[model samples]
Target: MREAPPNAVAAHYATCTALAFSAVAVPFLPEAVLLYAGIQYLRGFLYGSRQWRAPARVPLTLGRRGYRDATTRKRGEATWPVGTADGRQVWLLRQDLAQGCAFQGDDPDWQAASIERLVFAACLNRMGAVVVQDHAAPPLAGRIAAVARPFGCDLGMAAIDLHASLTPPLHLTTSAIEAALGDLGLSEKAQELNRALSPVLRMIGTRHGLNALALYRAFLDAEALSTLSRGEYEIDGLTVNTDGPASADAAALVDLQALGEAEREEARQELAPYARELACTTGLSLTDGLDLGTAIAARRLTCIRPASPLTAVLVQALCCEALAAQEPVSGSEVLVHLGELHALSADTVRRFLTSTTAAGAIGTVALPSTPDATLMRLVSESCRIRFEHRSTGKQWHTHLISTLKDCTFSRDIEPFLVERSGKTGNI
Candidate 1:
């Protein structure tokens, strides 16, 4: 008798094995073995003696334009091309896996879910479940399975059984999968599983749910850095009351007076131009406006507890501006006042002035000195800074002096007026 072709001989043997199992109802035959027999029967019937072909390797590209699979026209809603340890290929199909699954990366639990899915796919493939949608059908399935068998040791029934024994449910959550793995002492498998799973997760699809969490974290970090860079490392000095009585601790009273005197000096020293300019602008005599502005500036500098040192300087400047009325202070005047008020180096003061000018908190002028020696002064007065209180629902002001302090200024201003309470004052 003529020898049959190798393909026919293999097919014939596979068919006999299937028939014998069917007749005896063997309990030990693996699902893949049964699938192997079915595939041989189909190949012999459909393709005859044609040699089995390797599956077409598809290149997956992820981009702004979305997912692209090189070999097939069919597109999954979400798809990923995964490589097995044995160099075999399995392209995962996206389904309702994401419907209830928390979004990847956003949810703390997603990585664990990813590991479980990888384990599930490997196990399912061993049980004759085709993990690759492209190779799920007749003619292709037979060839793919044949190619997969020799190195399918890791994808075998025993490994699959180990996973199933850990978790009984067909559907899994990240927590459930993790708990099962821990219970089964398969915790050691997690790192390898995660390494294998991460690439596939990236290859899969949409990150719609993860974007919000990422944005929030980014904003928080940026805000914190900005605060630090601005030297806002301490609590704002809140307005305190010293009117009731002297402190029981005599030392505290002395300390408070010393602090207040220091602030008063900061407010009054080197502020003559700012005071005079404001007085001339307000239709008041230069002497009267200057005197009044200096007093108010000193009072605010001494009494107002500012959130930051910068705020204290701003408040003092604002008080002087209020005295000036319609006249704006020159940049040089402000620079001089701030310079006298703070012990900061010239460079630090210049940087602060530059930043405040750019933010419109203060106005400036160009000086004629060489670039390094040149400096600017604050010219404008009557500036206001407004902000919303995120939690309190109260609108707040960070002006050189708050409206709450207007009453105190008014008392000071009365003495400077040409006429006070229908009577002539000393001014």
Candidate 2:
């Protein structure tokens, strides 16, 4: 059998020591406190340390009467109550209850936060239902959905099951959301939120037969694209400039298909060593493990636009040729092939390749001593691949517009676009 990594061994030893200390201290400490600490430690070990940290405490009081006048009020299926504090009622939804706390009062900031959480929960619950129905895995769906919940709320199966049973169900319609927010006196911010959230709502509602992973990816993509449309032009280091004229810098067209395959292969190779250990511990298949690992790893890969059009075309064509050949192609071989096809000079092609490689549009095994060394195509899967100078900006704008259309919230994110048009900036 293979030996465990040093970090893994150290982690195991620390966990065992902690548990032994807890057991020894149980006789002297309060049972409730010990239980809570144990639960928190287990949560940190299982999920992550980041998720285990406690949120800020917001004090709840009931006017002069303090806790005496506070009473639990039920609205629909919300597990938490609306508390009376200083003559103002603080509303708590099921989402707040899931996090073990609620905002202190009806301040605009608190209201806004509440509204955002409500909308997110409604959308996530709807997505979870869709996944459960489409995948025909009702038993596993609740657990999976609970794991996928946002805001570091690791809810139990019971809370998820309660959400699943909400009456009339959660709808993504504009009026429904507005009406919900209106109750909290936040109808004024409805239009602003509609712009921010429409793309994700529309993508979820219109697309059919999306699995859990696909739905999650769509959510992330739509959110990122929506932010871009609003003139917030930085997403994982990729620049968005949908309204500008093409710059003189060369553009690089990423081959998403090739990149996705490469990423999957890399994920599989990384997971292969611990396959048996993971199976015994988590009861997950290799495919399921790969899906989870890929989702996490993909966030680290950055995709940027190339500065040269010639470099962009060269990289795009080289990637296509490499994919077809199912192996890395030599720089000299590609130079000859592209020269014959595009009537390009050898020196120009070589220069473009060097520039493209430097920009990380392509990869190389090593610096070629001779012209026979292989060139590799590499890029991020999330990148858009448009080669034409005239249509690149238009394509981005069109893509965002299409995704934002037919959403249940606002019709378009034009306000952000109009505001962004007046500014002069790059990235």
Candidate 3:
């Protein structure tokens, strides 16, 4: 017989191995090993072969007139070339894997489901159940098997959450909030509770089945609200109770006056403007919005309240803008600035800036504002220096970003912005 060429000899051995597993060993396996090996062989030949000749590339031009990608097309009066730099035409290569890479970021469901699918596949293989009736058959059934195991899915989810591969917490702001909600098992229980509540929405006038279930299950006692501190959510100085007795402990009561005075000073202390121009623009006549702005400019700080809600800083910012602007600031104007600054809702902002009751909040937006706010602002600004005792105090000053050092006290507080332009306040 004629001697087989070296490549042909190698290919013959590979083909023998492939057939041995595909036809001979397959009969004994309810397991996926035989099938997996067979499919992988084809997969390698089609996609991962180093020995195979590269597919022929045909150049195609997508013009300034635009060609179809079937999903998105940039519409503009711009002309661009889509050919090779050497003047050779460029060819488009479509890769199945490349298409997957487009949406590489993980969705929430991926954590649990991906794990479940993987573990289940392994288990199925070990159990002699990993099977491929035909090489051409899709792997949907296998994927479904892996994804459907409850305990396996749960464990996978746990593993995902436990691994903090990339993200690190700055101050525990996000993690703290999540931890405070509850542990992992609680989340699953809560999900189950939500499913149980879905049919009762129209019966009880609640829309979110999950959230509504959580709320109802949260407190078993109706009187729980009264027993809890009602002041939990209110600002330090914001609440005034006309009807209730004091909740102060004996030790607290002893220093109540001193504490009260100190807190008053805190509220009244001229805070550093994020930027001077923002201060001036808000139109607070209290000591020239410029001067207050200057002090804040000196200090790269905003109102420091550990207890402050997410809205506290935002409202403070809105007020600053209103006070700075020379024109009468309508609610809409404040909302507009807020929109420009961050994507916060007008409703959330309204709580901090506007008081609908006849008696307005201490820091309501005044149309050219009442003279009283101006006078108070002026008096507060008149003080040469307003010192705040930060937790780190002097050392903390070093950590202050230099970018903020150049900023002036600004009325332009937002969720992310530290200061605004043109206004000056002392730190």
Candidate 4:
């Protein structure tokens, strides 16, 4: 007979010694036996010669005590075991078992189903049934399950779950607002002006249901009207003479303010065309055919606020792009892709990912196989970020709202009025 290899002999002796120790310790130290058995089983499942297989059955008992594995019963509740392919069992749970019988015989669908069941069961055991159920099948569910398998679940789920229940709107402090404004390339004077205006803007928001973008648009309109009131203003390198035809048309709108309410309503309709022409010609930014004052009067101006730095839509897009790729994506590659697509800088992207404000909407996993280099994959689909007060330990959550396509800005601002012939249109 062929002699067993040296490694096999060592393993055999190790198993025998463990079994002898377990036999002697069972009576006085039953817990030690169980622990040793579990450790050995996990070792076999992960690194032993036999392949890991699942959906194995064991008898279950539900007597006066509670549910447990029954030693002698031939028939029992279906229990799935995390074990080696050759039948060494690691872990089993009665309450969380898969809802199918053991692998009775070989069938392709059954085999596939068994693998799926194992994946689902493992994820459910780790992340709870809700997370497992939330992800869709084919790719997302499979990918999430694969992620959960090694780490035994996203450790961040507890914080995420806690925050989801009590999420609140983002409330930027004066300092936070200043920092965000600075990031947008605002001058120090501009930042101070915005800071001074924020309280009033926030009040306006509360009363009118206007968001940050709408408030910014209102400020811009006011600024533009003030410039037009001067009869001349320089923007960029161009000197705009509001005293020209565009200004005359806009000044006509000021006259409507003095008329009686009923008369003003009638005059607005008659004057709207002239206002539209003036807006098309003289407005600094593109206008929807109404000058700032006329738009304010008609309630036709609409502006959507830009998304916050860590919006869910942005994070989701990043994750989807990375996961859908045929090959693994590096951390730097992800940042570059996001920056190019969304006009975000690398520092901004990094800040969002690492910020405690992000709650735990996203997480990263390092690829172990790539020893020479590092690779990462995102691991969650949650849509909330968090904020915590350092002194009070009080927490606030911000649900990452979906962004609108039309509201998104992908390019630099364009001049509303372009000169045709020697004169600008409507001027």
lDDT of 1 at 309: 32
The lDDT of model 2 is 0.26
Using TM-score as the measure, the top candidate is 4
Q: What number of backbone clashes does candidate 3 have, counting pairs of residues 3 or more apart or in separate chains?
A: 50
For model 3, give the 10-residue run with minimal summed lDDT. Answer: 96-105
Q: Against the true structure, whose lDDT is highest?
A: 4
lDDT of 4 by residue, 1-427 (tens): 0123345545654675677576784574555655655566554433343222222333243212222222322233433233322233323333222111112112222222333334334343332221111111121233333434444443322111111223222222334444444544545445544444445445434544645334434433544434433444344456556467445433533432334444433433433332343223221111122121221122111111112332222232323322233122121111111111123343333443443112211121111111121111121121121111111134211111111121111111111122223334210
Q: TM-scores of all models? A: 0.14, 0.15, 0.15, 0.26
Q: Model 4: runs farther than 4 Å from truth? A: 1-7, 10-181, 208-212, 222-342, 356-427
Candidate 3's TM-score reads 0.15
**Residue 315 alpha-carbon offset, candidate 1, angstroms:** 39
lDDT of 1 by residue, 1-427 (tens): 0123546657676776767667565565645566666666664544333222112222232222332232232222223222222343323332211111111121112222222233233223331121111011122222223333443522322110111123211111222222222322333333223222222222211232222212222212334323322322111232222232322223323322333333423323322222232222212111111222342222211112222232223333333333343222321121111211222233433443443343222221111112233222221121111111111234211111112211111110111112222444221
RMSD of each: 36.9, 30.6, 28.6, 23.4
Off by over 4 Å in 2: 1-171, 190-192, 195-237, 244-427
- Residue lDDT tens for model 2, 1-427: 0123344544655665567666775674455445655564554444331121101111232212222111221112222222223333222232222211111121222222222222233333321111111111123332333333442222321111112323121112233223323322333333333323333333333433223222223323434434433433342355634345422111211111123333433433432222222222221111122121121122111111111222223223333233233222221111111111122233333433443333222221111112222221111111111111112332321011011111111111100111112342111
C-alpha lDDT score of every prediction, in listed order: 0.27, 0.26, 0.24, 0.30
In candidate 1, where is summed lDDT lowest over 10 consecutive residues?
Answer: 406-415
Roughly what TM-score does model 4 have, to 2 decimal places? 0.26
- Residue-pair clashes per prediction, in order, are 13, 7, 50, 1
